[model samples]
Target: MESYDFIVVGGGSAGCVVASRLTEDPDVSVCLLEAGGTDSSPLIHTPVGAVAMMPTKINNWGFETVPQPGLNGRNGYQPRGKTLGGSSSINAMMYARGHRYDYDLWESLGNKGWSYNECLPYFKKAENNEVHHNQFHGQGGPLNVADLRSPSDLLERYLQACESIGVPRNHDVNGAEQVGAMPTQVTQLNGERCSAAKAYLTPSLTRPNLTVITRATTHKVLFEDKKAVGVEYGLKGQRFQIKCTKEVILSAGAFGSPQLLMLSGIGAKENLDVHGIPQIHDLPGVGENLQDHIDLVHSYRSSSKRDTFGVSMQMVVEMSKAVPQWITRRSGKMSSNFAEGIGFLCSESDVQVPDLEFVFVVAVVDDHARKIHASHGFSSHVTLLRPKSIGTVKLNSADPYDAPRIDPAFFSHPEDMEIMIKGWKKQRQMLESNAFDDVRGETFYPVDETDDKAIEQDIRNRADTQYHPVGTCKMGTPDDKFAVVDSDLKVYGMSGLRVVDASIMPTLVGGNTNAPTIMIAEKVVDSIKQQYALLKQTKTASCEPS
Candidate 1:
């Protein structure tokens, strides 16, 4: 059994950052296991390649939820990345840190050193923003954040539409406040996708101290007397065990992290009994508190396909030319991230902050874009930034290969439906603005556009995830029964084990989760280094003096 100072499971967004930063200190050797293949596909690099990968299992987990009764008995599709970069390699690459109050809420929940003020440094430390150099933005960092290289004219139109509906333009969504519309800043470098793997892992690949194993699926974390010591995993049908001399960090994302803990017999006794897995530690919150941004999309057919992407014969010819244009110059349609324009607004006038987030896409997206249409169109995604309903991730079976049962419980809360209805109503005002008069053709759903009941029924029939799922293994104070990990991200009642991913969020952030997930990894890496530094100092002093 080979050993390392640290073993990080899941080479997704957070895992990449942890492995890269830990290996920066040559003394600390680290091993990173990725369940998927390497992020070497052209589909993982080109910005527009995201659309092609969404419908296929290529580098995507493509998990489906248990039928949600809230969505009129529909099974929502959940696509996660199965590559070294993880979802970052397959996502829209929108770089958003949520709102300042989002982190402040973490501190208010007794998670010390996690307030926006404390977390800001880590966000800056991980970012290399190409534009907006201010106190909030950073330069000379690993993760590159920049404006879109090929922004669509529809983006301007979307902003104009928002303005027509009394929404102001926000120059910088990540700075000062997140209250208005703007062209989304993306995680890209030179018009290419700057996934966490590209930003963090690619540069650290040559480091001998960092051992990155792709196509390796971790079955369970091995523990000795409730202390994590190693992990049992499979690679090419061969089961193997690797020792962790110091710590076992689970960065397998929200879903994978909690599922791994349960597999390791560290969940509720009742849950383990059903699966016949012996309980090591009973933590009831292993897979509880699942939260996601439930989104309602409005798709509209367009009269012209000049700037919008479509699936017609004309676009086939356009894309044939576009493919080479992007390969050679790294510019044009291929560089567009699709969901280019963003807006933040309040569902109710009395709300303190914006609760509704609007994502404007340059093409029609049906069922997370899995359903393709031959017509030219655009879509506006209205996501409830924070939902009151909670969900769970339970074991489908004892087999590690089986996908976990995901129940987001979207709209289970009456208030969630209420807010969503209001948000959908507000979103329609923007969709019908005069700015889109020249391009807009036909509204796809909600035949009775003015009726509130029709709009509510339409939302219940079509509402789904915006792909931001979090808070399964939540971070909280020790006394909190639902807490999976403490403020420092250390698993409660367990030593040598930590969770450094979106799962650690006590509550979901208000925007895209990718950037905040990277920041969590950065912050946790700092904690890991500081802990050992203090230990080293104590050991040195004990040897030198009394």
Candidate 2:
């Protein structure tokens, strides 16, 4: 068996960061295991390539949710990144840090060190903002953040429509306030997607201390007397074991982390019994507390195809010319992240912070773009920033290769539906503004634009995920029964193991999760380093003058 100081399972966003940061100390050796292949594909580097990958399975673990009663018994798509950067490599590169209130809420819920103030340094440390030089942003960081190389005029019109209806223009949503409309700040450099792999792992690839094994799927976390010591994985149809002397970090995202826990017999006793696996530690909260953003899209066909993307002949010819432009200069249509403009709003006047968000797409994205439209169009995604409904990620079977059963019981809570209904009506008002009068055509899925029941039914029929899934292995105080990990990201009742990904978020943030997930990795690395430092000092003192 190959041995290393640390082994990080899952080469996604968090795993890449952990591996890169740990190997900075030359003596530390880390082996990163990724189920998917590399992120060197041009499809992953191009911002617009998300359109092709979101609905398909290229470098994506295209998992589907169990039939959601909340969605009238319809199964939802759950696409996660399978490669080095994880979902960050496949997602629309919107660089949102979420509302400051989100982290403060995490601290309020008994997680002492996760307050916005405490986490801000990590967020800044991970970012290298090309434009904003404010106190909230940082420069010379590994991850690059910049405005879109080429934004659509209709996106400006969408912002205008929001302003026309009283929304302010927030130049920097990642700055002080998040309540307004603005062009999305993306994780890009020179108009290319800067996935976590590109930002962190790519730079550290040559370091002899760090080993990244792609196409390596972790089957279980090997343990001895309830302490994690190594990992069992499969590569090229061959099983292998790698020992870890220090720690085992699980960063396989929200779904994969909980699934791996159960596979390792560290979950509920009943769950282990059902799977016919012997139990090690019974952590019932391993797969509970699943949360995700449920989004309702409102799309309309565009009268003119000048600025929109579609399958029409006009767009085909335009793309022909546009491809060469992007190839030579890395600009034009191919550079767009599609979901370009964003708006944050409150459902009611009494609400303290914005509870709803809008993502303006320059294409007709129906069914997460699975059902392609034949003509040019535009859409706006109305997403609930905070959802009240709870969900779970459970094992489908004992087999490690089988996909985990994902049930994001969306809209199970009456309050979630109530808020979505209100948001549905509000988006219509925003999109109906005169700013889009020249381009807007018929709605993609028409409802009685004013009737509450029609809008409610419409929301039920079409609402789905905005691609942010978190809180499966949530962080909380030891007293909290539902807490899976502690403030230091250590798995409760277990040693030499930690979860450093979106799965550790106690609650869903108010915006896109990619940036926040990267921030989580950044913050957890400090704790990991400090813990080892204290151990080293204790060991030294114990040996001296005793």
Candidate 3:
């Protein structure tokens, strides 16, 4: 069996950062296993490649949820990245840290050392923002964040529309306040996708102590009586085991991490008995409390093709010219991140934090863009930033390859549905503003916008996930029985194991998840490094000329 000081499973957003930073110590040996291959595809580097990746499995896991009764029995599309950078490489690349109160809420939930004041350093440590640099933003960091190169005129109009209405304009959402409209800052460098792999992993290749294994799927965590000592994985249908002398970290994302734990018999005992698998540890919270940002999109058709990625003969010709423009100058329509404009707002003033987040796209995106439209158009994605509904990720079968049963339980809560309708009403308010007169053409989503009942019906028929799923293996204090991992991220009642990903979030944040997921890694690696140092110190003391 291959052995290392630390073994990190799932080379996604958090895994990449953990492996890279852990190996910074020349003495520590680290091994990173990625279920997918390298992040070297042209589609991965190009900013506009998300359009194709949203539908194809070239770099995506392409998991589909069970039929959601809330969305009129619709099975939502869940496309997670299956490559070196993980979803960070496949996501919209928005660099948001949620609101300051979001982290404070973590502290309030019995998770110590996770407040906004404590987490700000880690956020700063992981970022290298090109435009903003202050007490909030950072420079000379591993993650590269910048503004979009060529935002569509329609995106600008959307922001103008936000201001034209009562909504305020925020230049930086990741700063002091996160309650207004602004152009999104993306995780990009030189107009290319700066995924976690690009910012943290690629540059770490020169370190001889670090090893990254690609296309390796983890089957289970090998246990010694109770403590995890190694991982059993497979590649090309062959099984292999690797020992970690110190720790085995599950950074396989929200879905992948919980699924692996349940497969290894560390989840609910009742569920394990159903599959006839022996229980290693009975943690009922292994796959419970699943939360996601449920979204409702509104679209409008426009006449100009050059302004959007919508279907048109002029768009085809313009795209032909865009190819060379990107190949040479790295600037043009190809440089757009598609979701260029963002807004965060409150449904009710009594609510302290904003519950609604709007993402303005340059093209018509519906049903994960599966059903293509004929006309040029733009879409406004109004997502319930924090849904109260709960869900689960249960095992389909004992087989490791089988996908888990994902039930996000979207709109199961009556309040969530009401909030969903309110979010769409806000989207309508922006669309109806005069800012869209020169650009906006025809409203196509609600059909009838004024009726509240019609809007609620529309939500039930069309609402789905915004691709941000979290809290399966939640982080909380031990008093919370269903908490999977503690404030330190160690799995409850287990040693030598930890979960570092979106799954560890006790509650979903208010904005995009990619940036917060990376920050989780930066914070947890310090914990890992300290443990490694103690292990080294104990060994040195024992050998001191005794």
lDDT of each: 0.92, 0.92, 0.90
- Model 1 CA deviation exceeding 4 Å by range: none
Better of 1 and 3 by TM-score: 1
Q: How far is candidate 1 from the true structure (C-alpha RMSD, Å)?
A: 1.0
TM-score of each: 0.99, 0.98, 0.98
Deviation in Å, model 1, residue 486 alpha carbon? 0.6
What tens-digit string does per-residue lDDT give for candidate 1 at 80-185? 9999889999999998889999999999999999999999999999999989899998899999998998788889899999998778899998999899999999
Give per-residue lDDT, candidate 2, residue 405: 94
RMSD after CA superposition, every candidate: 1.0, 1.1, 1.2
Model 3 residue 333 lDDT? 85
Q: Write the per-residue lDDT of candidate 2 for residues 1-546, one digit (tens) a residue.
A: 899999999998899899999999898999999999999888999999998889999989999999998888899999999888999999999999899999999999999989999999999999999999989999999999999998988988999999987778999888889899999899999999999999999999999999989998899999999799999998888999999999999999999999999999988898789889888998989999999999999999997687888888899898998899999999999999999998899999899999999999999989988998788999999999999999999999988899999999999999999999888888888888999998899987878866888887888788999999999999999988889999999999999999999999999999999999999999999888888889888999999984
Q: Is candidate 2 or candidate 3 better by lDDT?
A: 2
Q: List the candidate 2 regions with Cα displacement exceeding 4 Å.
A: 541-546
Which lDDT tens digits does candidate 3 get at residues 241-338?
Answer: 99998889999988999999998889889989999889999898989999999998888887757888877788889899999999998989888899
